[model samples]
Target: MPSEGRTFIEEARRSQIIECAVDVLATEGYARASMARIAQRAGISTGVISYHFGGKQQLLEAVVSEVAKTATDLMMPRILAQTTATGMLRAYFESNLDFMRLHRKPLLALVEVVTYNRGEDDRAPGPYAEQHETSINDVIKLLDRGKSTGEFRDFDSRSMAIAIRGAVDAVPARLLHDPALDLDALAGEFVTLFTLATRRQP
Candidate 1:
């Protein structure tokens, strides 16, 4: 019982520290955000963060995981609610972009972490690369479903998927540069363009 209590408290503390790390990363920039700063923000000792996460890289990974989970949570319900493939595609991108708008700070922090956090080998964000592949595969699945239903024209689904993902992925930088960027307008525009491009001939 005592061990269970300790485990629960440890999890709670780890959650708090990760939350504070996201806040610090967004506000301070990735290069400037240190574990000590995150600890200060969380009102905990730096040793506690180190004990749980080991280092900055691990903490950044945790932040990325949290942000991705949040995005999936926002996107999956909307995607599942749609019966049509076109509807699912729109739901996937629009809801995802909407999630970005709603959770700008955390998403931006994720961008910073992915763009700036380098490993010893100086590779690109390992998690972003993996997640991008997963996203593209999901888009391909939607395209294939639409094709199977005779709703979409027979085109290269992988190309389309990559294009759509590229457009959506570019939004974070745009929003950062122009805070007043209209994401819904962008979302509607992209969905309409793709729908027209992919729809079967009358």
Candidate 2:
């Protein structure tokens, strides 16, 4: 058994490694983010990285889980507080845009993971797929709530969730490829598209 202080220190060190791993992966890509590089970025030794994560894949998974938790932590409260579906949907898009702007590195890593796994079996039990599903479920629940309140048209929430998510994901890709793209203008377009798609008929 470890001393309480030592346990806390170890956990802190592990957290530091996890954070550094994300940075390294984002900057260097998964294929090049070696334990040594991650430790160098963390100001720790390779042994420490190995002690905490056991290997690269484990560290990548932890990074994915951390990124997903961070995204949820940022958005879930606003989502839970909304009394109307339209409000919830607006909050959802705004939160995603805000998150992408503030957390660019993790979002970049997320994009990389999605592109890498584009057509693969995403059903496998892993952090990437798990995070994807969590985000989708959150949107679906909000849509269902909106429909229940007669705020949105009665459409399949799951399909609508996919469309909304696709738009959110595509924004980053477009911005990445074209640095001159105006995100504010794109966001306005997104809002218009979302409203038009979900707006209830008169």
Candidate 3:
């Protein structure tokens, strides 16, 4: 049981360090969030970070994965709760905005990391990196389903899906500039806009 307890403790410390990293990155931006800052936030020595993650790059990847997992876990159930394709698509926007509203800090940090943080080669986060498109793909699936069911018109589901994801993603920067930005109103607008764009006219 000693080994099991040690493993559990290590996992706990990793989680703590990742959470602190998210907070630091979110509040201070990528350039300012160093290993020492994250360690200080977690109340651990810098060596603990090295022992657990080896360096900042690994920790940044962990932070990205954690936030992506969070968005999936939070939004998937809501998206699936609706039966109709339009309803599913609407749920995607609403649930995503709700998540952004609730988990602004970690998500903002996530955006900064993917957009600004570069590997040793200095490349932007690769296609294999950053926020996965599972959620957006799910929206595309809903559009395809609606089209199959004669509920939506044919007009490039893939393009529309990308547009929809882009719309909500632009919110974080807006919120940064104006913390009081009405995300709910914007979500509602997107829901209505996309619904009309995808739906067949009666």
Candidate 4:
């Protein structure tokens, strides 16, 4: 029943609400990011948020999907363009750290979402599961490419992928817990460790 302009405005408003929710979730964890708080932060009515996203769970899902998509879009091209496995792996770590630094709020929210449901059934058909699987698959693909080029050692790419993922996942917690931690230095160390782990030995 709305006009085109009105629909576009509504969509924009919804996007704003989702972003605000992400900020709240990142700063105040998911449990504290209530509908009222998010609406207040977005400068929108709670009813509007409810109308658009149904409830907090749906809004959280939307936020997760948006953040994950943004990260994948930003990193995938850099990863694909690398000419060597080492170069690709370096690109992956650097791009990931840069994304985390630039998009701290949403990235923190993503970490919270991940940690909050760590032991849950990650294989379930949902946005969280899909995002997790996509991340693992991307890393696996990179490892496979590396192995194909003889740049990486002959090992289970899947297990190596999980280890790489674990390192990336651990960074956010370290940063949050110790603001003085040198992330750049840590990233270099991580890249070195990853290279050592996958390097083809003589």
Tens-digit per-residue lDDT, 1-202, candidate 4 = 4434458777788789988988998999967888999999988889999988888778878888889878878888988898898899999998898788888888888877766643325554544766777788889998998999899889998889999988998888988888677778877998999999999998
Off by over 4 Å in 1: 1-6
Could you say which candidate leads in TM-score? Answer: 1
TM-score of each: 0.91, 0.85, 0.89, 0.87
lDDT of 2 by residue, 1-202 (tens): 3434458778788789988877876778766678888889999899888887777667777777878778878987976787777877877877777777789898877666555533224555545776778778878988888788888898988999999988987887886788667766776778778888998999
Q: Provide the lDDT at 190 for model 4.
A: 86
The lDDT of model 4 is 0.84
Angstrom error at residue 192, model 4: 1.0
Supply candidate 4's per-residue lDDT for 141: 92
- Candidate 3: worst 10 consecutive residues by lDDT? 123-132
lDDT of each: 0.86, 0.78, 0.83, 0.84
**Candidate 2 lDDT trough over 10 residues, lowest sum:** 117-126
Return whichever of 2 and 3 wins on lDDT: 3
Collision pairs in model 4: none
Candidate 3 lDDT by residue in tens digits, 75-159: 8898888888888888888888888889999878877886786665676553225445775676678889999989898889889
